[model samples]
Target: MKPFWIYYQKEMLEASRTYKWIWVPAVFLLLGIMQPVSTYYLPEILTMSGEVPPEAAALFTIPSADSVMASTLSQFSTIGLLVLVLAGMNTVAGERATGTAELVLTRTVSTLPMMGAKWAAMMTLMLVSFALGLAGAAYYTHQLIGPLEWGAVASGGLLYAVWLAWIVTLVLPLGAVLRGPAAAFISLGTAAALSLLSGLLPSRFQWSPGRLSSMAAEWMLGAGAGAWAPVIAALLIMLLSIIAAAGLLRRSPLSPQS
Candidate 1:
């Protein structure tokens, strides 16, 4: 437990040193604010561009607040997910690349504790960034759009966070076996494929983590059904990823090729 906290603190400090603590959350907040703000100003924007006729501009109406919030989640699903994966892609691989993992292991801290700490730190960043972004989106949506149900907002955010979690967790095991960039690419590719499959066959892929984004949107819209299956599957996948990362690190603490 002590070792885990120590490593967790080290990971947090590393994030701070790298300025990830600043940029990641700032990007998320920007992305979140952009959605509602853009949606609110679409008619004016179109008018300024002179692309749409005056008649067409008059036909435009702001979407419902719930829809705007859901759209904000969609924005997070793409760019936000990429940002998180890139931020965490090197969590393990970078350590190995710099010989830091080997040095840390020499201190008698086993692979599991170290891996657990890395996972926890990455999650902490993800949660904090997401929360900030969601809050920003909600606040803007309320002021520029309409009131929101705080209960649905919280529930929807949790579901979206889980969706983000499993994808980010992919970096752990993938990074243990691949270079940082390659690991990030593969993690994103996997997410894309799953999301594509889930969209193409909603009935067949009901339990897929890919459904999490849409599920979150539906939940926010008050049309959500219970989706325990995908939640459970996501939890299982995260657990397996941690275990696989630990095993891979134990075998090769210095580098993937090693």
Candidate 2:
């Protein structure tokens, strides 16, 4: 077997044993369902809460179907992103810490395959989790809101997935250099900074990968039909993260604890 695939299989087996495959997607599914259902029932919920004005229910307006779906992706942006980052934070760093890095490095001729495998496994989990969560959100959106344009939804989901992949990929290189929690913190911080800067200077940073989350929402509204700059930038960043991870692991294949 190819080294990369071999290591990828190991990662998969480990993921199964750890129940990550089950719980991660479960969280995403719950988040996906919560948005539409909550939106659908917001007025009722507020009324039940007994803190609003008597006239508030009349002022409540149900959002459009596409908007609700887009907001579901936004939910993924905050809590979903946090869960995924924490889950993948230890890809390399944990291996190094547990002394697995030394064993794997001793067997392999190069760290590139292991690094590639680690990245590929992460992409697998991210893709599957997001796909499940998006599916759940889409199903609820269609059932509650109305019919949706599958083409735009697919495009938007792809943009958002790539945006997610970019951040998750950071864990690989960061894990090679720092402890697991530190890697997660730095990666999340970088993502937040980019997103904040992009929001503050959109015209100047339209090509930023940070616009991807917004772009995903825009696609749901059929507003980003021709936008491609952010997608390209995200791809470039993903490539860079992969390359950086390989180099960093080559330099320090073992963790401080090991």
Candidate 3:
């Protein structure tokens, strides 16, 4: 247990030191900032470009600050999964490819603990990035319009974050199962396929994790608690995937070096 924390701490420190780490938060925040800014000013931007007719422009106007805020939250809520896919794609696979994973596993740490440490770090990074992005988007939304339902906005943000975490569970295991570019490409391709399938599936299948990316914002606007069902279900599935991956990983032998 103590060793797990040590490894977890090391991974966190390494993550903080990497410049590439900046891209995760920056990209998420940029999308977050863009959401509200675009929602608030889209009409004006379109008008400047003469894209909307005077008669049509009247219909396109924002009704209230809440809807604009909702629209902003919705925009990034769906798109934010890409952040998880990109960041998590290389997590375990990169380590395995470079022989670092073998080095770590050779220590007293068990396979479960080693995987847990990485999973914990990945989970923390994902949540923190999403939260910061949400706060930034909220502030921008408030500035563009007036005060918003902060409670609703915050809840929506959290729902989206959880949804993203669930998606990461799926990707992280694939990262652990495959190595290097093969793992990353496979995870990314799977993400795209799942997204496409989710879109075409029936409403009952909407409970799937893939749909959470699209449904989170709606969860906020409607019954905030209702979304928890799918979110929790997805989390459970993610945990199961991790457990299964760990079992597979524990049985596999590390590649021998001549």
For residues 1-258, what per-residue lDDT tens digits would candidate 3 score against the true structure? 987798789778878887436877887788778877877777777778896786776678654665665566555544565666666766666665566766666665357776677778888888877787777777887888678777777776777777667667665567666754565566556656665787887465656666665565665455443565567777797778777666755655242331
What lDDT is reached at residue 170 by model 2? 87
- Lowest lDDT sum, 10 consecutive residues, model 3, at 249-258
lDDT of 2 by residue, 56-145 (tens): 886999998899989999899999999999999988889878887777778877777888888889889989999999999889889987
Model 2 RMSD vs true structure: 1.3
TM-score leader? 1
Of 2 and 3, the candidate ranking higher by lDDT: 2
Tell me which of candidates 2 and 3 scores higher on TM-score.
2
Best candidate (score: lDDT): 1
For residue 32, model 2's alpha carbon misses the true position, in angstroms, by 0.4
Q: TM-score of each candidate? A: 0.97, 0.96, 0.84
lDDT-sorted candidate list, best first: 1, 2, 3
Model 3: residues with Cα > 4 Å off, grouped in runs? 50-59, 73-79, 185-199, 223-225, 253-258
